[model samples]
Target: WKSLIRVVVSGAAGMISNHLLFKLASGEVFGPDQPIALRLLGSERSYQALEGVAMELEDSLYPLLREVSIGVNPYDVFEDAEWALLVGAKPRGPGMERAALLDINGQIFAEQGKALNAVASRSVKVMVVGNPCNTNALICLKNAPNIPAKNFHALTRLDENRAKCQLALKAGVFYDKVSNVTIWGNHSTTQVPDFVNAKINGVPVKKVITDTKWLEQEFTERVQKRGGVLIQKWGRSSAASTAVSIVDGIRSLITPTPEGDWFSSGVYTNGNPYGIAEDIVFSMPCRSKGDGDYELVKDVVIDDFLRERLKKTEAELIAEKRCVAHLTGE
Candidate 1:
């Protein structure tokens, strides 16, 4: 246990929360011995449902869980928390207009951001997992002016892991053997998954595959549409892995990456590293832990082909930020 750690999970009774709570209770996400005090934040409408879930968590007798509480107010839950996982938002239901959805979530995140800035611990770390995650994260970061920009991030490790799995299957290599793969820019269909520097047994993937056209048609499309495929197959949105990716994202933030190998995360970029937009959250390679924080694993070269995809993803993120700015008057 690394002392008492306060974790506030917004949307804590939702689908992703159902999966995440057990993980946190079991200490799989954080350390096994670390005692946790969970403050769940949800809307007034969902308060009773969240309370039921919290009761179940308590009955489960999780050794590391020191306490659990459900709150309808964001300010009540945000106080003195070391970690805040922003998972709740207005999801993009079928036929919902994109602008309307963004506006709704932008409003939610903006309020939470202000609450966090006002109350959370000075060293709080935040991860926004809602749709339009990068922009939602940016809205929160911007609203929370007191928090460091570097502390806010969006979730994109799921995309990165999906890319790694696809590459491993295509290359006939163990998933562990594949290293240095990077997912650049937004967490959308336009995301750039770079294979130029990826290696299988230390051999460059580009040299081994030698099929640029195949890569363009098969690999890229598969990586981009993975979430859609899963949703179609299961007849529901992605849940378990959404929680798993949340774990992976936090682990990559606190645990050091091994030598010559790194994981991907949606993090703030300075643009020089990967030409990603400065002052905005975008998925990029990172390594970190303890008192130290995530730093971009830059120096991976981007050819013209990769550059185009990166630009497309960045454009989407930029437009999203603009939309939020317009909505919030920031």
Candidate 2:
């Protein structure tokens, strides 16, 4: 029998997890030779749904899946976890302001952070997928004083993937032909989908597309707001794509990056070359060596326009940090 890699997933009954759980169990994120023990976390109100989800996992009989446990409390579910996927949070209600949503989720992450610090593996890699994920990840890391902040990540691979797709379609090439697309700053509308550094078919995107106006305006806006566009067309938030991005995000961390290529993730901004604010979770170009470690890609050219866009997203993240100051102890 293969050794078990303990993984804790919060919001286990949500739409995103509905898709993600199967992928994890199928060894799509981790390798086929590795086995995993899933510890599922959910709210008391969602316990039955969580049970049903577990039942389905049991029915599927994935070869790489070894053990499964379900609970409503993070403290109970987080023990010895090597990977924590914080995918659940209260959604923005009809009249709820963004600040209010941050505060509510801030409390949730703060408590979970403490739980993780107390029980999870010291080297656990956490991926925060909850909305306002950049700020939520910051809050989570801040509250977990014992855990290194670098272990926490906000999901921005979706934006990076979106940017690559846009560039591919505009250049009339396949999506895989596009590379080096970096998502800078928070995971919000203000996030910068940096076409300046992206390439198509091993050539700079600007050199191929040749439409400065569309690249600067249409391409960036489309990537940044692609989530909203999907919701508008589908009448529901993106679930399957979001799940796939989570897999991609985690895979990027564990797999060695291709030479001359980098992926985007929301990482701690301290020591970052681009002068993003310290102690905040901001997305940037990153490369990994398949050892569950990554470093920020340095010396990427950030033109004046991209610099200004980065500043806007940084300011928004700073304001969000201040809004959750009480929870984060900022």
Candidate 3:
């Protein structure tokens, strides 16, 4: 029998987690041979909703789902968990400033990070999916001094995926044909999609597409604003795609990255070789060794355009860190 791995997912009752929990339960993440106990954590307002979610999970009868637990307290849900999906955070509503959103979610993530530090396995790998994810991850990592900062990651595969798909469609090739698309700096709108490094079917994207205008202007803007465009069209933020990206981020951390290809993930930059300054969570190309460990893809060429965008996103994350400085205990 495969050893049971406990996975904790916060915001278990939220729209995105609703999709993620089922995927995790079915072994889409850890493999079907791996039995898993899923713990769902929510806040007081969503505790009852979490119960309903648990019931639905029970009805799903997922073969790999050895157990299911739900709670309003992170202390309970985070106990000895080996993997944590920090998915729940307050969404930015009308008139809500970015700083305000970070401040509100800061308290929640602070408590969660402490809880994880208290009870989670020393090897726990955390993937932050909540908005302002890069900084929220920084907050969580700061509070959990026991956990290696490298074990914490923020989701940026979504932007990378968007970039690849855009290139694939324009090139009339399969999505998988486009590879090595790196999303740098942040998960927010200022994210820099490094098209210069991307490849389609082993051919340089620039040669295949031949539309320097689109690559330089349209494609980057679209990838950066993809989430906002989704919200504008759906009247809500992305759920399924976001959930898929969460799974992608987690799987990437646990599965060895393929040769010659790397994925985008936001990671700590305390000693990064990338020109990004230390002491903040920054997104960059990364490769995993299938042990919940990743190495940043070093020596990536950053042109003037990519450099300016990376700097812009870095400033935003630094500002967010300042916004929640009081909560992080840093």
TM-scores of the candidates in the order shown: 0.95, 0.99, 0.98
Reference-based TM-score, model 2: 0.99
lDDT of candidate model 2 versus the reference:
0.92
Error of 1 at 16 (Å): 1.1
TM value for model 1: 0.95
**In terms of lDDT, which candidate is strongest?**
2
The residue-level lDDT of candidate 3 at 252 comes to 86
- How many times do residue backbones clash in model 1? 3
Q: What are the runs in model 1 whose C-alpha is more than 4 Å off?
A: 289-292, 327-329
Find the 10 residues in a row with the least total lDDT in model 3: 298-307
The C-alpha lDDT values of all candidates are 0.84, 0.92, 0.89
lDDT of 3 by residue, 137-196 (tens): 998999899999989998888888889889988889999899888998888887899998
> lDDT tens digits, residues 1-330, model 2?
557899988999999999999999999999899999998999999999999999999999999999989998888899999999999999888899999999999899999999999998999999999988999999999888898988999999988988888888888898999999999999999999998988888888889999999999998899888998898899888999999999999999999999999999999999988888888899999999987889999979999999999999999999998899999885
Which residue ranges in model 3 land beyond 4 Å of their true spot? none
Q: How would you encode candidate 1's per-residue C-alpha lDDT over 1-330 as one tens digit per residue?
A: 478899999889899999998898889878877899999998888888998999999999999999998897888899999999999987788798877888999889989998999999988999999888888888888888888988998888888788888888887888877788788878888887778778878888888778888677788889888998999999887999889989987877777777777777777775556656786778887777535377777677788888888888888888887777764455
